[model samples]
Target: MSFLCLHFTRNIHIHAFYLKFSRILSTQNAYLNRFVVSLRPLNN
Candidate 1:
């Protein structure tokens, strides 16, 4: 029973870590896009 509990807790920890990583990746992508936009002058 204790082994099963440990396995379950480990799974939960991994799931939470992935969720946080995904969120950070999305935010980083947004920042990169903004940085690229700023690099080019939009003078028409």
Candidate 2:
């Protein structure tokens, strides 16, 4: 029973961590897109 609880909690932790990591990745992607867009004016 205790083992099951532990496993469940671990799953939740991993899920939260993954969500946070993905959010960071998305924000970084947005920044990179903005940077690329800004550079386009100079490129042409």
Candidate 3:
């Protein structure tokens, strides 16, 4: 029925959003890690 179709569509949208967020989060984490490493002194 129409309700079932709507539910399916909503679920797909939420899943896609989560996937995109995860990708962005991973990229952000990598950038932060590099920044942290750069902050450390070479002698340490």
Candidate 4:
């Protein structure tokens, strides 16, 4: 029973960490997309 509880909590922690990491990645991706779009006109 105790092991099950530990496993559940560990999964939750990992999931939360993954969510945070993904959010940051998506934000950076958006910034990169905007930066690329701004540079496109210059290349033309």
Cα error, residue 32 of model 4, in Å, equals: 0.1
Scored by TM-score, the top model is: 4
Tens-digit lDDT string for candidate 3 (1-44): 99999999999999999999999999999999998899888738
User: What lDDT would each prediction earn against the true structure?
Assistant: 0.94, 1.00, 0.96, 1.00
* C-alpha lDDT of candidate 3 relative to the true structure: 0.96
In the range 7-31, model 4's lDDT, one tens digit per residue, is: 9999999999999999999999999
Q: Taking the tens digit of each residue's C-alpha lDDT, what string does model 2 give over 1-44? A: 99999999999999999999999999999999999999999999
**Poorest stretch of ten by lDDT in candidate 4:** 33-42
lDDT for 22 in candidate 2 is 100
* Clashes by residue pair, model 3: none
Clash pairs (backbone) in predicted model 1: none
- Candidate 2 error regions (>4 Å): none
